[model samples]
Structure formats: structure tokens, C-alpha cells
Target chain A: MTKLMIKEREVVVPGDIIAEGMNYLPSTGTYRQGQHIMASRMGIMRLEGKVVKIIPLAGKYLPRRGDVIIGKIIDVNIMAWRVETNSAYSAMLSVKDGTSSFVRRGADLTRIYAIGDYIITKIINVTSQKLVDLTMRGPGLKKLDGGRIIKVTPTKVPRIIGKEGSMVVMIKSLTNCDIMVGQNGIVWIKGEPKDEILAVETIRKIEDESHVSGLTDKIKNFLESAKR
Target chain B: MAYKKRSDGRKFDELRPIEAKLGVIARADGSAYFKIGNTEAYAAVYGPRDLYPRFLQNPEKGVLRCSYGMMAFAGSGDRVRPGPSRRSTEISTVTQRALSPVIDLDEFPNAVVDVYIQLSQTDAGSRCAGICAASMALADAGIVMKDMVAAVAVGKIDKTMIVDLDYEEEAFEGEVADIPIAIIPSSGEYTLLQMDGRIEKEDLMKALELGKEVCKKIVKIQRETIRENFKRSEK
Candidate 1:
């Protein structure tokens, strides 16, 4: 028998029993102990059918494989480029994975991705040792140019993206701005100065109100009002 | 000696008035300002960011570094130094250990979480107060922890067990024993235990039990403060 110990969207702290029995499964920010499911962090409970997860209200980003992230090149070497992923662990982008072109050995990698240059990349792998491997060969992955990068809590990134990219698409259409969201909470926005500011403000509002219900509708209303 | 009430007119097992507030520092990742009777302390938490000085970085878990300091005017009579003293260093080490167990450092690798505790007023149990406030600050910063740590000092005053000792009570030359204890209320696990002055075996047990009860009450206040802050931010 599966028993839900907490309501949907209720805040819970670590060690709080969120559920009981094996009929339910635990996801991110939660852990399982025997027949009980417990919260592993302080966050709001998210019940998706039989899958229970917790969305943290605050904290730095923890990189995961296959996540599209924005990284700043911190160091360059012959074999790879060390990129700061806004996480505790820095990521590495090998020459072969970074670009399709084949270059000879001893080639200056700085020309490809110099220090302090922000790039939109994907996390190809993250080992148990926390060594992150990044790739920039995918679609929509490249160096961000002439755009302002704003950060929000990484846990709120899903809210900014909305359900199936609805929220981000809505913002882009309303402001005519080209925006890219990194799984690590870095947002790159390229548009008119006024539109850029509006987009940033709207994203921040979404981050702040992510835990509230009817947020998508609220954001839609906000964008409409701003346009007027 | 005849039994007498404390200068503050509190009972033997009574605790000092406690006030705890979270997010007091706007610039810090998480901050708390708290007062226990006349003793006031402020604590701020920063990072889980990359630990610099390369050699200090831990590969498996994040490191928590705490710095405990007393302001020059914090003491009642003589002005104390503003920087870290030998006593402050010892307190900082013990405070760090008290808080380290609760935080799930494995979630953050190669990072350092720095906690800075400043005592603005001294009333004998400031270190305990600092630990309590620093734990609140860590939770407010949204660091994942198994539980919050709460601490209190229990002492024998004129053969009476008192929960919190003020400056005068602490400095009394009478036969007394001051034992400061920090515990995770939910688990009843002691993270810190220190004793000053002599204590008999039976009296030590009594003091531990009383300290645990008082710490439980303090933990309740800590949780309430964090919850209230979260509620306010929701709006």
C-alpha cells in the first residue's frame, strides 16, 4: 500500500518522511530508506503520478549528463579546455568533442575557445569522480556573442523553461529576443536593450514565483501587460 | 547556601529569552542575527563555491570553514581585541565540527562553505549562541542538511542546575561547573561537548539531560525562524 505522507507542493526538510511503501518511487532531492521515502533536502514536494521529487528553493547547480549548460572558459590546453560549469566541478571540452574540424597536435586551443568566453555547451558525461565532459557540437551549441548572461537559481530553470518550453517560447515571441537557458541557471539574452531588460525581469519573476500554482498563466498575464 | 533566584529572576531550569532572525544580511548567501538574553551574535554563510588555494580543496566532499570572532566592545568591562584570539580559534574549530555533520557535503564536491560568526555582546554562553545562529544561517542559505544543531550551556550555580549562565553567574568563584553541549535535536546526537570546572558523575548526567531539553526548545525556534523567512519570501 502506497501512502503519501505529504501533499503536493508542500515544503519539506531533510529527514522528513515523504512517503511509505515501495509502490511509490523517489526522485531528485529525495531518498529511499527500506519501505519509506524521505526528503534529502529542504524543498517543495513535487508529485508526478507515482514519482515523487523535491524542487530545492535555493543552492548552486549540480551538473548532470545531457544537460545543456552555459560555461565560461577558464583555462585552455592542447588537448581540452577547462570550463567552469557554475558548479563545484569544472568541465572539460576536448578538441575532438568541441569541434568537428580536425587540427594537428600543438595547435593553439585558445583560438577555439579563449579564456572568459562564454559558450553554450552540453554535458556529455559526468563520472562518479565528478569529472564533467562537455561537447559543443550539437545544434544551438556555440559561443554566445554580444549577449548579457543573467543567473537564477538552477532549481528554477525548469520554471523559466515552463512545461515543454512554453514559457521561454512565449517570452521570445513577446520580446523578440533570442534567449538561451543553461541548465546551470545561466541565461543568454540577445535583443534590443529594452527587450533584454524586460526579458530578464520576466525570468526573475518566474524564478521568484516558481513554487506558486497558476504561474504560467501569471507569467502570460505579466508579459501581456508589459507589452501594453 | 540558601536557594535564591537568578539575577534575572529566572528558575534553575529556565532558559534566557532567545530571539532568532534569518536573512538579516542582504549580501550574504544566508545570514542570521540572534540574541540569547543579553548575548547577541550574527552569523553569515557563503559559498559551496570552488575552494581556492587548490591544496585545500577536497575531492569527495565540501569543506566547511568557520571563523568565530568577538568585537572589541563585546565584553562587559575591558575592551577585547577585534580579531581572532586563541579562544576564538578554538571555538571556531568546535563550531565547525558541530555544523559539519548536518550538512550533506557530498552534494557539493571541490567546494568550500564559509561561515563567519560575530559576537556583538558577551554573556558567557556566546559560543553556544554562535553555533545555534550559524546553523540557522546554513539552513537559510539552502544548504542540504540532515538536521539543525542547537546548543546551550548548563552549569551548577550554588548547587543548582541552571540552563544558561550569564556573565556574573559564569564568573562566580563558588563551587560551579559549566558544561556546554550541542546536539541535533531530532537524533539526540551530541556534536559538541565541553566542560569547565569540576562536575560529579551524577551531576554531569543531570546537566546533559537538562541541556538536551533546552536545546530541543532552541531548535524549535530555529525551525520557526527558517519557516517564517521562507513564507515571507514566498510573498
Candidate 2:
């Protein structure tokens, strides 16, 4: 027998009863305690067939494979550069993965990616112990120049991009600013100061309203109205 | 004279009017304020981030650290000292232990989650109030937890066992026994139980039963406030 105590998309906090009985399986942000399935974190519930999972709305970034992220260089060494990936785990960008071309064994790593510089990179690997490795050998992977950075809830990154990059692309076109959003929640915006502010404001709006439907039209209307 | 009437005129099963607010500290990963009657506590949660002093790092999972202190003017008696005392240290250790069971930190290797609790005012049951606030802050910080914790002070004042013991009742000139307890509501597990003074076995059991019911009420407030926090941020 299966009985669900909550609705399909209800917001739940830790220990909230999602369902009872053994017919449904708990997954992701949920766990099974005896016959009861409870939420283990705060998030929105998603019911897929017989599986009940919760999509977390807030948390620090956790490294994952193949996700392009923005990280700040924290240290420089002979073998690699330590990068803060906006996560609990610090990642390493080895000399081999630091650049496409290399000359010698020992070179000044700071010249490539200094401790204070920010770069767009991709996570190539993350060990079970959460040792992360980063690479700069892909397109759009490079050091970012001077720009203003803002942080958002990491879980909202997907919504900030929207379906097929429509939401972000719309903001880029509307504000006439360059913007890059990291999956880890660090956003870099570069343009006129006013344009940068507008971009930041619009992105935050998207983050706040991500759960609401008809978001694209609402954001478009907001941007248009703010411009006038 | 027998304990005829509650000095505060509250029912034996009644608790102080509680007020809770979430995310009050913007810079902390999670923060909350909890006030029960005249007692108030503020708790902030930080990390799941790197822990320093390389020697203290745990390779298997994250460590939870807690610091509890009261302001100099927060005491019902003499002023509290400005630093960690024996009593504060004891409460901090117990608070850390009380909140540890529900949190799953295995996903964060070589990391630490720090909970800092401060009491701005006190009546009695400051430790219980601190535990309640810390639990809410931990959950608000998005820490994965199996369940939520709720804490309250329950004790026997002479022949009457009350749900929440205030400062006056604690100092009553009769046989008084004060017990502060924290519980994981979903499973009815006791994570914290400490008592001062003495009680018979049957009386203690009855007081603990009242404790469980009071904890349920505290959990209800915690759950509603946590959900309300998200709803407020949605706009």
C-alpha cells in the first residue's frame, strides 16, 4: 500500500513527510525511514512514476564532471595551480591541463593563471573523496578580464539559463552586456557600469522567479518596462 | 504551602510565546533567531567548507563544531562573563552532540560545519533555546539532515511538573528539578537530556512525557518558519 502525504510539487523542509508505505521509492533529497519517506533537505518535491525525489533549491556548489564553471585561482605551484571552485573541495589545474602549448618543465605558473585571476574552466574529474581536476583546453575556456562578479543560489543556475539558453540569451541581448554564468553560481558581467547593473538585476530577478511559470514573457516585460 | 498556582499564570502544559525568524545574518550560510518567553538565542551556521589546522581534519567525513556564549548582560542573576566558561563549554559540547545525529556530513570529506550560538537574553532554558536555534540554522543552511530537532525545558516544581520552566520557577524556594531536553521529533529520539535536582522515577517519566508533547509543539513552529522562509524568498 502507498500513501503520499504531500502534493506533487510541494515545498518541504527536512523531516517533512513526503509519503508513507513501501509502494513508492525515495530518491535524491529524500530518504526512507521504516515505512515513511521523508524529505532530508529543503526543496521542492518531484514525483516521477513511483520515485519521489526532491530538487534542492539551495546549497553550496559541489563539483561534477563536464560542468563548465568559473573558479578563482588561489595558489600557484610548480605542478599545478590550486583553484577555488566555489565548493567545499578545492580543484587543481595541472600544468598539462593549464594550457594547450608548453615549453619547459618548470615555468612561472603565475604568469599563466595568477592567484587573483578568475578563469572559465571545465571539471574533468571528481574523485569520491571530492578531489577535483580542472582543464582549460576547451572553447570559451580562458581567463576573465576585469568584470563585476555576483553570486546566486547554485541550484538556480539551470533556471538562470532557461530552456536551451533562451533566458540568458535574452538578457544578454536586452542589456547589450557580456555575461557568463557558472554552474557553481558565480556570474561575471562586463559592460558599461549601468548595463552591468541591469544585467545583474535581471539575473537576480530570474533567480527569484525561477519557480513561476511563464517566466520568459515576464522577464522580457520587466526588462522592457525598466528600460523606459 | 503546595505549588498552588503558576507564578506566571500559565497552564502547567503551556510554553512561552515563541518567535522565530530565519536568515537574519546575511553573510552566514544560514542563520536564525529564536525567542521563548524572556529567553532569546541567535545561531549562525557556516561551512561544509575547508577546515584548517591540518591536523584536526577528518578524512572520512565533515566535523561539526559549535560555540555557545551569552552576552554579559543576558543573565537573570549576576552578569555572565565575556568568554567561554565551564558552563558555556559544556553546553556547546552537548549542543554539538545533540545536533549531530540528524546531519549527514559524509558527503563533505575534509570539511567542517561550524555553528555559533549566542544568547542575547536569558530567563532560564537558554541552552534549550540555543539548541532549537542551532537546529533551525543548520537546516536553513541546506545541510542534509534526516530529521529536525526540537528542544525545551521540562521539570518538576514541588508536586507540579511544568512544560517550560522560567527563571522565577527555577528559583522557587521549594523542591525544584529542572530538565532540559532535545528530541528528534520524527523518530522520538532523545539527543539531549540533562537534569538538575532530583525526582522520583515515575515523576521523571511523566515529566519526560510532557517534554515529548512540548517538543512536538516546538517542531511545528520550526517547520512552519522554515517553509515560510522559502516562501518569502520566492518573491
Candidate 3:
């Protein structure tokens, strides 16, 4: 018989048996051993249909291919611009992949993307050696300007966006701020000074209360109050 | 044989009071400050970040580096040197070994996780406490692991097997074995085992058993601290 050993939303530590039978598939933050599925990190257990996953409360981001992320240009070389992906691995944005417009060989690459500029890019590839390749040739992918950047836990990025973009859209409409969330936990907000500050506070609140139930209603109430 | 009871009045199998706190350092990815009786230690975990020097980077797994140090005033004697001494280096090696088994290093390639442990006040079982605190710090950092490691020192004092020896008991000379053991409580697999001084083989077995039992209790406290940290963050 299939059995779930842990209650949904319960906190579990490493090696705690989350499920006892193979009927349950283990996802991220968990591993399988014999007939048991055990948590591999300290986090809250999330049960979704047949999948048992753990949502870690804190950790550094590890980049994956095809994720849209905000990165800082740290170094510029002949062939590519090195982008720090808010992770241990640095991604390379080659001059060819950097822009749709092509130019002569050995053209100055720094002028296109200068150091310390934050850009939204998509991960094109991640080699087995952890060499990450990034591309900026997509819609809404380019250098960010005249916006303030704020950081939250990478794991909370999904919560800030909410289900089907409901939460983020609410915050943007209420505060009149244009917000862009990076999968790597960096958020860019641009608006009038007062509205930008309000957006930042609302985002922080969502991050702090992401694990609690009824958070969507609570955040909505908070935004309504802030509007006044 | 009747023997003089310990000055602190603990029974042969009794352990010192434990107090542990997680995420004590705001700047660190994970941190813990804990006290076992008079022995106070702080451990901080940083990274899964880039490994420096390039050569030490493990392509297949992350490197775990531990630096164990003692404050100059931690000891009872004259002012101790304020750097990594021979004793500190050895302790650091053992601490790293004790914690490495639990961490899933393969999850982050070319990364290095650094655990820094400072014993600000030491009784006798400081190394054991350091291991416990370091493991909690790793958990706080959200590092994936197979299990959490708990450790304790069991030594023969006055021909009696005592759990968690203090400074006064450890100062006893000759024939008294001080065996420190760290284990994954759920799996019962030992990650670290070291013995100083000689004891009968049978007594060594007894000490190992006692050490494992006490480690379970410590593990419970570590888990509670981690849970409390997450609960507070929820607000």
C-alpha cells in the first residue's frame, strides 16, 4: 500500500523518511532508498499528487539551463562577457549571442555590455563542466536601467510571482511600479520613488510569509492597506 | 568500588546542559552558537560558492573546509596564542571529517563550503561540541545531506565511564581514555572516532555505546533549533 509518512507543510530534516513506499516519487530535496523516500535537506515537505518534494528554507542558487535570470557583468574578454549568475558558476555571453545585430570581428565588446551592468538573460546551455552559456536575444531581455535592485531568497521567487502571476501583478498595479523578478532571487523595480519603496516592502513581506498558508489573502489585504 | 563523585555532581552517564541557537550570524549563509555546560562555541557556514585557488575545486563534488580555532582566553592557563596552532589544525581536520559524510557535496560542483568554528569557552569536549554545531550550521545553510551528525566524548574517569568529560576530568593523567565519536544518529554510522589514552577493549565498547546514546539527545536539540529558526522566519 502507498503511504505518506509526513504531513503536508511539515518541516523535515535531512534523512527523515518522507514516504515509505515507491508509489510516491521523490523530487528535489529528496532521495530514494529501497522502499523509502527521504528528505535530503532541511525544509518543508510539499506533496503534489504523486510527487514528494521539499522546499528548502535557505540556500544559494544553483543555475540550470533554460532559466531566465538576472546577472551582473563582472568581466569583459575578447570573445565573451562574463556574467555572474548569482551562483557559484559564471555564465559566458558571447559577442555573437549577446545581440541580434552582428558587427565586425574584434569589435569592442565592453561598449555593448559594460561591467557592472545588470542584464536579464536566458541560460542557453550548461555543460557538464558547469560552463554556462547565456543569451540576450530574446524579448524583454536586455540591460536594465534606472531601477533599484532588491534581493530575496531564491526559493521565494516563485511565491513573489504567485500562481499564474497573480501576486506580482497585484503589487505592480497597486503600487504603480514595473517589476521584473529574476529566477536567481534578484528583483528590479522602477517607478516613482514612493511607489518603488512600496513595491519593495510588499515583495519583502511576501518572501517573509511565503511558507504560511492563506498568504495570498494576507498579501492582498496588506496591499489594500498600503494603497491608502 | 566506591568512588568520589564529580564536583559538578553529574552522574556517570549524565550529560551537561545544552543550549543551541541557529542563524546567529546575519552575514553568514548559516550559523549557530551553542553551549554545552561551560563550553561555548560558534560555527558559521559560508558558500557552496566558488572554490578559490582553482586546484582544490572538485569537479564532481564540493569541498568541505573547516577551520577550528580557540579564543586566547578560552583556556584556563596563561593567554593562549591567537592563531591556528597545531592543536587547532588537527581539530579542524577532524571536524571537517565528522561533517563531510552528512553533506551531499555532489549537488554543487566546483563549489567549496567553508565551516568556521570558534570555541570561545572550552571545557573538555569542545571538539565534539564543534562537530555538533558545525553540522547544524550546514543544515541552516540548507546544504543537502544524508543525515545530521551528532558527537560526544566519552572518557573513563576514576575507572568509570563518563559521558561528556569536563576540563577537570580531562586533566586526569594516565590510563584514562578519552574517546570522541561522531555518528549519524539515524543510520548509526560513525563519521569520526578517535581515542587518546588506553582502555580495556570491553570498556571501549561501553564508551562507544554511551557516546552514541548521548549523541542522539544532542541531535534532537539541533533539530529543534533549526525548526525554531524556520518558524521565526515565517513571521
Candidate 4:
């Protein structure tokens, strides 16, 4: 399995001698000069002098078709819950999509996810207009109330999440905080009095400094120090 | 000596203490919120992407679209809806022009760049502040441009030219002609231009010169804001 490292928004053209065994191009994609180092998945790409090196693009919060994200029920209407996606365009969680269970005629659906209720759901689709669709039927995907919500740079969510579920699992184990990271940049943290505070602070620190390198190390130190 | 007073006790020639915050809106590609005393404005940048069908899109180069809006209550009194009005449209056009000269529009072809400006507070020079905020937002968005665009308003009040006017002072009982301009001080070019009332050609020339001087100061402050933001972003 051959892999190429992409750095600084550029990839090396294959067959070009790159300082004797520095790094080789990935076998999957063809490289052209001046082409943007496409983030195959979402991540941070590192490059050195036109040679690919480190890639940290692997993280969750990947917005996919029909993947549910917990959203704040911002507006209520006769139709559905207008969810603020923490982005420009809000999404709609229709009364019909709320549950397979029956909703009586003109029943106040607000009983389900009222204003400010954070519900977990999936992105049914995203229109070109930037509109988003959401659903609620999934594991651990449900309404959230009485928890503190913090907004961060949506692009940094993957970084905060770390590789696979490792980062979040570490946070959960360290702080013992029940954190649900919404793909839309909203994070809900709930736990014991002191643990919740530590978790929120650590998450906020990650948010403030997410653009830098070696964040995982910093986060690890944070969690470790908090444990002591 | 007939002297008019400002709400903040600033003299007619004086400018308010300027404060700016970039990246206020975390989600927008680039965003900034600024306050010049009581006058505050928020700007957000979106795209160098394909233009929507409803809007006019330039073929050869990217089209820059600016939307300037004032909250009804942004003035001294009364709140208003968030929508486009004639004043906002005019301001948007001038601001867009001010930015055109500095932006490397050719870098983004067959696309549209949208700048949304919302006035949270309003005194006078809202348009000028809007231009400044928009420029900062563009920089925050990481859009490539030749130089920073800075703007300020210069007006002839009581036969004397003053830089940066406030509402109460501008509305003082005298004939005042104000010109708000966006200038690339390094290149000495104007991208945004507007004049209200009338002034002698020489006074206009002088106001233009003063406007440039004021903009140079503003540009320094603007760069500092961008630098501070970069520093914090690094942290």
C-alpha cells in the first residue's frame, strides 16, 4: 500500500525527485502541479517545501447524507422545529420525521423538542441552497435539555474529536463528562459538578487553539493534569 | 466661535475611539464585528464560488456583492427589520466599489463574493465603518487582495473640513457636504466614493486629501486588528 503525504495545500508531482527518500506520492490519486491538496476526508494537512509530510484530517462530525446531529430547536411552528445548524442555514426536523409514533391532529408537538431542546439526529440531506434536513432515530440520538451548550468553529470539531473516537473517549474517561458533540459545532457537556467544568474548559481551550499543531498532546496534558 | 458638541464630547474634527473584533461569527468563512464609539457593524464574507441564478454573476471575473443594512433601532431611537433599503443599497454599492480595486478578483473566476454588513449601532459614517468592517471580514476569510481597504468620511462643516463625523455634529445647523471614500492608501486609489451636499472644488480636493490621511491611520488600526486576530488564532 503506497501513500503520499500532502502538505501546505499542495501535493508533489509523482516521478519528481524529492530530495532522496523524503516522501513518495500516494498511489490512489494522480498529482498535478498547482493542484490543491484535497482533504480526502476532513483533516489538517502538513507540507514541507512542496513535499507531503503529516496529515491529521481524520475526525468525525463528518456531515453525511442521513446522518443525525443533535440540533437546538430554535423555532417552533405548525410544521416542524426550525433548527439552527450553528451555521448560516438552519435545518428542519419535521413533525412527521419526529417519530414513527403518532402525533394527534393539532397536538402541540412542542412537547417533543421545545425551544432550546437539543435533539440528536442526522443530516437527511443538504440542499445547494444550504438548507439541511434532520432526523432523530439513532443510538444515543435524542432530545437534550438542562445542559450547557458551547459553540466553536465548526471546522475545528474534527480536531476536538481527535482520530476515530479516541479523543472524545479520552475526554469522557478523564472528566467522566457525558459530552455529545453535534456535527453543527454545538457541544453538550454534562457530568459531576467539577468534572463538567473541567471538560467544558478543556473543550473551549481546544476551540481557541484548534488551528495549531500538536493539539492532541496539549489536550492529553490537559486531561492528565485535570485528573491529578 | 460657534462650536458644536458630540454625544461622546468629541470635537467636530475628532474621531471616536475605534474598536474592532475579527472572527466574531465563528461559522462564516470570514467575519468581523467593529465599533467606532457607538456606531457598530458586523461583516461576514461568503464564497468565491458560483453565483446563484437569481443574482447577476460576472463572467470574466468574480463579482463582488455587498449587502449593507441598518437595524431600525441602530439609530438614536426605534428598532427596524433586517432587510435591504435604499440607503443600504447605495452604501453597499459604494463599499463594493471601494473593495474592487484592492481585491484580486481574477483569482476567483466565474464566482461571486458576498459581503454581508449588518449595522448594530448607527451614528454617522456607518457606511465608512461598514467598509472597514467588510475589509477586515475579507481578510479574515483569507481572501487574497492586493492591499487593505480603509475608509473614513470627510466633510466641510462651517467652512472647515473635519475627518470622521458623528450624527449630532453632522446634523448641526450648517451647510455640510460629506464625502465618504474607501481608499487604498498605499496605491492612492479610490474604490468607494460618495458625496452629499456640495463643496467648492478646492475644498473637495482638500477633503479628499484628508480622507486619504484618515484612511492611512485607519489602515494601520485595521492591520493591527488582523494581526491581533492572527496572534490569538495561533494561541
Against the true structure, whose TM-score is highest? 2
Interface RMSD for model 4 amounts to: 11.4
lDDT of 4 by residue, B51-90 (tens): 7783575555678889999986787776766677676777
What DockQ does every candidate get? 0.49, 0.76, 0.72, 0.06
Model 4, chain B only, scores a TM-score of 0.92
Model 2, runs deviating above 4 Å:
none
Candidate 3 docks with a DockQ of: 0.72
Clashing pairs in 1: none
- Residue-wise C-alpha lDDT for candidate 2, range B92-137, written one tens digit per residue: 9999999999999999988999999999999999999999999999
The lDDT per prediction is 0.88, 0.91, 0.88, 0.70
Retained native contacts per candidate, as fractions?
0.44, 0.73, 0.70, 0.07
State the iRMSD of every prediction, in order shown.
2.2, 1.2, 1.4, 11.4
Looking at model 2 chain B, report the run of 10 residues with the lowest lDDT sum. Answer: B226-235
Worst 10 residues of 2 chain A by lDDT: A100-109
Model 2 has an lDDT value of 0.91
Clashes of each: 0, 0, 0, 14
Segments in model 4 whose C-alpha atoms lie over 4 Å from true places:
A1-207, A210-216, A223-228, B1-13, B78-82, B233-235
As for lDDT, the candidate ahead, 2 or 4, is 2
- Model 2 DockQ (Cα-based): 0.76
